[model samples]
Target: MRGPAEAEAEDFVAAHTAIARPALVPEIPLHLATEITPIWQATEAWLGEQGIEPPFWAFAWPGSQALARWVLDDPSRVAGRRVLDFAAGGGLAAIACARAGAAVVEAAEIDPLAHAATRLNARLNGVAVAEAPGDVVGAPCRWDTVLAGDVCYEAPMTNHILPWLRGLAAAGARVILADPGRAYVPRGGLAEVARFRVPVTRELEDRDERVVVLSRLLG
Candidate 1:
């Protein structure tokens, strides 16, 4: 589950290209990959630099980097496709899609702040992005693929996203969700495609590294 600190960091992102820290700050932040840069803080700083904060959700918890690992392993899934990053937070999955050669990518998030953060992070990572307001699932969209990461940590989001995802699938959109065994993960026909052991923190306890990956329904 994503923690409060992470949410706060996202809430504080800037809209300019560079940001100055106003205080020492008190949130324990985690970095992406084997780097020392805290992803949450970096995202906030990036947003601060940009100088814009859009409306966003309180806790669109992104699971432990599961989506990143998969994109690095097999980058072609996004190549030359129009992709949607549903409920995108910090735009990690969207960044992965951009890196994978997606023709066009959009970060569809509900929160104005999170949407701001997502755009900031995407730009920092040199990823191009388009923004779709509110929960983008039921809205009219044109996408070849849809990706979700760590959006199932709550019952409400699950209830809303699940049926919408299934509906997208039924409409011939290639959809994939990345999770690390989150509590609300549904028991359906989802088949694990890959897994990883990601380091977690105190707020996310009982984790012996997160097993992360994309899933497919196996009949």
Candidate 2:
């Protein structure tokens, strides 16, 4: 059974966001913040009490958008495979994988609110996406394909997770990484797979669009 806090968190997410489709991947609907400032302020205030991460869940980032587009364009990439959406914010890619007929789809995140948003979005899409709560960086390779989007933004975080991601690749998992020109993305060790031009909110990206590069992480 879900606790009161969990229910409250879900309520907060539903109350603060609107159901919208990502610009690039419009087939899947997500709970997205209509405006940036209000959600940021609300998240900051909520963070003071809950000590949770920022509201990355309130937007469909470029990397995730690209991943979703790629998977939807080619369902065979995920169909019949067990897939993982790592660091899934609003679970766009996970939903795409599920829609593409993956045998199983799991969305992993450390933020409780992100989990809530993912659950809401998955339900809205009428897809079954299992939740892998908390940090799953060091977990064994339980999936055939792992999708990581926009995760290399911070230096420390990139450093911490990259090795584990590579290990998963070495262990025979097809680890896919989508990057939107983030500063910390590794220059090497990534074979280009596909690219996408994703529309973005100027309030968040300071631009009209971002070109996301999808790559296969080399072990």
Candidate 3:
């Protein structure tokens, strides 16, 4: 166990954008929450399941749950807009956007399990989520809105990802983040639109979290 171990994105994860089931279907036989957990290719985001291993960065984070609540609370934020959910785990944010009335919605992840689970969760909820691959960092794409939850937990990801998020905003996409105060959240203008207390497993650390919804400030 030394140097960085890695797998080709295709071998471990799907390279193409995928579509998943909705979240409210109540029985996700295809997508088990445990199966979506991330391997310890990175850090300590793992869920401590008995048979399940650690390094669970791929599973859905608490902030994603917070965003889902926000959507359920107020669907107008995404009403009739095209939305992109970055770092989509279990496709929560993207599903929320669809539930909120977005005409087109996508959930993206680089991890294979996470990406696949995103699609499954979409089916679970009876919502549609188009899954996309590749790192969205510094990517030049256009969308009406971008929704991110719990993506800023790691320093490297935040450093690379936040700038791209800003770029999306610069392209006029309304970027929103549901952050529960991880160490790596980048600083920028954020107008609070909503907040929530979400339940999180002890394995991920931090219980009774506060989910903050920020409105991206225009420059």
User: lDDT of candidate 1 vs native?
Assistant: 0.61
Q: Put the candidates in lDDT order, highest first.
A: 2, 3, 1
Which candidate, 1 or 2, has the higher lDDT?
Answer: 2
Residue by residue across 1-219, what tens digits does model 2's lDDT show?
A: 668987888888999999998999988889999887788789778767644456898999999999999999999999999999999998999999999999999999988889889988998999999998679999999999999999999999999999999999999999999999999999999999999999998888878999999999999
User: How close to the true structure is residue 51 of candidate 3, measured as C-alpha lDDT?
Assistant: 52
How would you order the candidates by TM-score, starting with the best?
2, 3, 1
Evaluated against the true structure, the overall lDDT of model 2 is 0.93
Per-model TM values vs. the true structure: 0.70, 0.96, 0.72
Compared with the true structure, what per-residue lDDT tens digits does model 3 show for residues 1-219?
111222232223332223322232212222333332334422222222345333233445667666766666778878888888887766777777887788889877775556655655565578887766686666676578888887777787777777777778778988878788777776656666766666555555656445455446343
Q: Whole-model Cα lDDT per candidate?
A: 0.61, 0.93, 0.62
lDDT of 1 at 107: 85
Q: Tally clashes: model 1.
A: 22
- lDDT tens string, model 1, 1-219? 336754554445542123311011111121222222344355456456543332222222334256655664677877899988887765666777787888998888665665656655665567787877666767754888888777677898798878878777777777777887778878886877766656654343465455565675222
